[model samples]
Target: MPISRFPFFSSKRRSSEAFSLLRRFGPSKRIQSCNYGKSSRNGNGKPESNPLVNVDIQAPRSWGTYVIPGALLGFVGLAAIFHYNDERRAIPKGQGNKSSGNFVKGPIIGGPFTLIDTENQTITERNLRGKWVLLYFGYTSSPDVGPEQVQVMAKAIDKLEAKHTIKVLPVFVTIDPQRDTPSQLRAYLKEFDPRITGLTGPVSAVRQMAQEHRIYFKKVEEEGDDYLVESSHNMYLLNPNMEIVRCFGVEYNEDELADAVLKELKRTQN
Candidate 1:
């Protein structure tokens, strides 16, 4: 324990030297340089490198961004408009005439034809003048659908006569004249309303009449002696002059048929 003469050997001097060495070897210089660069880069409040840190980057937009969305919107708008038009066209003209404007005009649907009545007398379209005619094409041998439709037609005609003093002759023309002769027609018609008139003739004449009205019918042979008439279920409302006014499908009921007939009657009168 000798007392040191050099100041470097003193306790205070030794502590100051240790502090300088630590500062030289520590992260002070690196921290100072980083702060200086950051402040310089941010002097204009703008970034030198990428502004977003640890964030994904994307390229600039092209024309497809706008075009694609616009095209999709246009397609959707067109589809919606077409669907609206279809719905409008589905409505019948008897309900309203608003959508009737889009209906395409076609050829006249009825013409003159000579047929044999149930009384075995030859009848022509000319004989039914000045009378509204409800014409239906079906066979007497029709099992279910034809009979049901004929019943509906008879009921409608009766209702129309009772309500408006309007008389409509309901005519049943057979598509199967081979099986439904004049006597058979008379017997079959008696089962329904008496106002219904049954008519049957040669197969060629029946087929020509069906063609004029755009009706379809064919005979399908089943088991021995069992035959079926495959035909469309169509009913026609003809004016006094033998021109078709309106056509009905299988879905029409008695009330609907009568209402349609009345509307047409009023329209023709005006």
Candidate 2:
């Protein structure tokens, strides 16, 4: 009975060894933990080498994608701020600003000036104190925009004078005193309107006046005796008190100029 039991135990031990060998050599690892190094199995039963092809790296994405547009928006905001400041700086100091051809009340601008009129008489702001003045600073040699502006100004004055209530003195001051003598100024102004008072004086006096009124003028392209003078060419509307009320640029036509002056006149009347 003991020998028979030994045979049975030997057979059982061989069966256990056989099972262990099958675990070591057979496809038992397929049921165990996965091998992440080689993720997939090919048709030949070999593991695929490219882990990236099987792994979902696109999931759990980073939050850094919005940085560029946000940075660009910030840069654009800063640029706009700089541009606005530049525009503000470009406007004259005391004159707040104008909008779409509308005038705003600003600091009083002007100073006393001594200049000779076309009539060869010494003229000052005192002489024109009782009447409203439409004053302009320009040069006869202004090639492009000057004559047009003068024409518009003359037409505006004509229309204003035609109206019964308000009478305005139209004065043209030469930025180029060297070339615009009394005779030359008289003749030039008569072509526009005989009522247009043309003024010319010593360069120093003109310079001082221009500086006080914040006028900018420069001489360019000089040839022996003839040169071109460029100026702001601003037309100023002055009250009877000789204080500047508004400044007009070259943008206005005769009708527009007449309308603006009438508007100002009506405002003062009220």
Candidate 3:
């Protein structure tokens, strides 16, 4: 009966009363209403239809919910960019650095070592002289990353040989000497590129060669005699004098590798 307890107002009430009623509700329910109708004789003096009264509205989303996650994602992106840049900073070549842990501006790579080719021919680092070599160290039995890197090496050299005057020799030296014999190396490499000269030798020789190249590899047994070799996925670009020019990692795709190698060749030629 009282105006304070009974919130509804009677006819001829001031809008100030309605303002007081709206102030009682929290911010979320503060949708404005508009009443437009012909002047009527209704007992309550309210419009017959308040079209804007039931309008659907919502509160603005909190900045914390979206901003925190967005900031975290931005930070992660920056960290990744910095880490990638670090990998590239060790050696300067073309527009981007060669991707790998082993690098130029450091100790010597591409030392003299003896290895037998797929045909059992003695192929030493001396044999690689007077040749531009794109060399990778991996095992034939590698299931995933090894095949991809070898394929990249095969395709990149083929691309360079197509138009470019630079003749690059693609070489694969196996880490799994116990399994990757001359015959196995021949079969595995031929599938990707027949020109890829595969090399395999005794375990001690292979280990010594890997150390010379700063390549890390270890055999983890799976079941019985089956195992996997965890090794550095590095590819070395050697100049004609058998010196390491640049180091490529698993990061490079075929096209990128070809383009990078071409630029290095031109730089050296000039």
Candidate 4:
């Protein structure tokens, strides 16, 4: 048939035909085998020369660069809010304190108190209604601060009475009641304005009254005959309802006190 059925072909002729086939296709088969071996050794069955296999890796970015500035900004915002609130609390309630004409609600001050006046007449908080009251706490033995404060009150009262029909009762309460009896207070008050009223009572009653009005007072012991009353210099302006309208510090002078009283009167009228 073709090549006489092959079983009868000579051995030398078979060898020669196999050699010719190898020369034509042996290189392609050997290359495929080598590629398969390389893929198995790399573990993913991918070629070593693949571009995706040797990709360059980069490090992850840190969060501190963004986080620190955000925290600082938050802290600054909180401080600004607190400062705004503190400034608002410092604003006064009536006119003459500022020209803006804005009224801020002040703190609620003053409380109930009962004591005896210069005439030995019992005076309670209720008796002081329907009239504005200027209240101060001091002793007759005060060296310098007490007299100056009383003068300020007297001048303010004279100015108010001369200008307006308002009735203001300037009341002085003694912190040292041990030596300030009714007669003693009357004589001490005579040195100041005639419109001023002096009040004194038992030690317990005076202490209670001072506590109610937030007046700080303490007895200072001296080695010799010298004695002093350590206390805060405070003056309170009370409305007709016996409620504290404003508190004047030691910094205010006679003119400033008068101006503040006038502004308060005008504010009440409005």
- lDDT by residue (tens digit), candidate 4, 135-221: 889898889998888989988888888877567899999999888888988888888887898988889889998876667888898
TM-score of each: 0.61, 0.62, 0.62, 0.61
TM-score of model 1 vs. true structure: 0.61
| Predicted candidate 2 versus true structure: per-residue lDDT over 1-270, tens digit per residue | 998678666755765566455555555223232332212457665656653322222233356667887898999999999999655534253222233342435434577889999878999889998888888888787888788889999999888878745578889999999989999999898898988899999999988888777788888877786688777778888888887777788777887788888888888889
TM-score-wise, the better of 3 and 4 is 3
Q: RMSD of candidate 1 to the true fold?
A: 16.1
Query: Per-residue alpha-carbon lDDT of model 3 for 45-88, expressed as tens digits?
Result: 56655444443336778999999999999999999999997666
Which 10 successive residues of model 3 have the least lDDT summed?
92-101
Q: CA lDDT of 190 in candidate 3?
A: 89
lDDT of each model, Cα atoms only? 0.76, 0.75, 0.79, 0.74
Q: TM-score of the candidate numbered 3? A: 0.62
- Global Cα lDDT for candidate 3: 0.79
The regions of model 3 sitting more than 4 angstroms off are 1-107
Give the Cα-based TM-score of candidate 2 against the true structure.
Answer: 0.62
Error of 3 at 269 (Å): 1.4
Q: Which one wins on lDDT? A: 3
Off by over 4 Å in 1: 1-107
Clashes in model 3: which pairs? none
